[model samples]
Target: MAGPYWFARNIRAGYVGRDRYGKGVMPIAWQGRAVIAGFVAAMIGGGATMFLLFFYAHQMALGVVIYVILVIGGAGTFIWAVATRSDPDKSLAVYLAERQRARSTGR
Candidate 1:
């Protein structure tokens, strides 16, 4: 048997775009925004749950473990989405270089 796949098949390139400074990606479409929203929701919900577990339930060790897992899993999922959905041909470095050249030439 094969392991479960986590990526969405309908995610297309360009949904995420490279940052202006070539550091990272940003959402360029609704799909990308949805991914970001999901990540945010996961973090917020997990934090609240962890708080309750630590204080109300009196499970400090378990709460810490759960919170760590949530952070790792959420970050991994976000990275996977961005990696698989971003435009492959777009390079922010190339764009910035071209812009610099144009400025130097006064064009």
Candidate 2:
């Protein structure tokens, strides 16, 4: 099926490829990179806000709640994006084997 796919199983040349340990995927494309960047930014922003709220504003409870929400939400979204955007049918081992076969066949 054709799609607005942001990830692929072509590990050697995909934008997002399966991790070597068979646990996750890593960004190899600009789109995937942008997702990572956004996550990092969100985390940093949340941390700064939490720090300010806890120390300066004297709102420790609020700060903790907000920080927890941000962490859960951000992590959930990131995981969802990676899972939904990646090629689901193939694993790292499969891709590696395919690459090996292609190389051997000189194709």
Measured over all alpha carbons after superposition, the RMSD of each candidate to the real structure, in angstroms, is 11.8, 7.6
- Give a tens-digit lDDT track for model 1, residues 39-104: 887788778888999889999888878777877887887898777766655343444566588789
lDDT of 2 by residue, 1-107 (tens): 21443445444444444443343575534676677777787788788889999889999888888878877777887777787887666544565567688789998
| TM-score (all chains, Cα) for each model | 0.60, 0.61
After TM-score superposition, the amount by which residue 56's alpha carbon in candidate 1 deviates from its true location, in angstroms, is: 0.7
Angstrom error of the Cα, residue 73, model 2: value is: 2.1
Model 2: per-residue Cα lDDT at residue 73:
75
Cα displacement (angstroms), candidate 2, residue 63, comes to 0.7
lDDT of each: 0.63, 0.67
Tell me how many residue pairs clash in candidate 1. Answer: 0
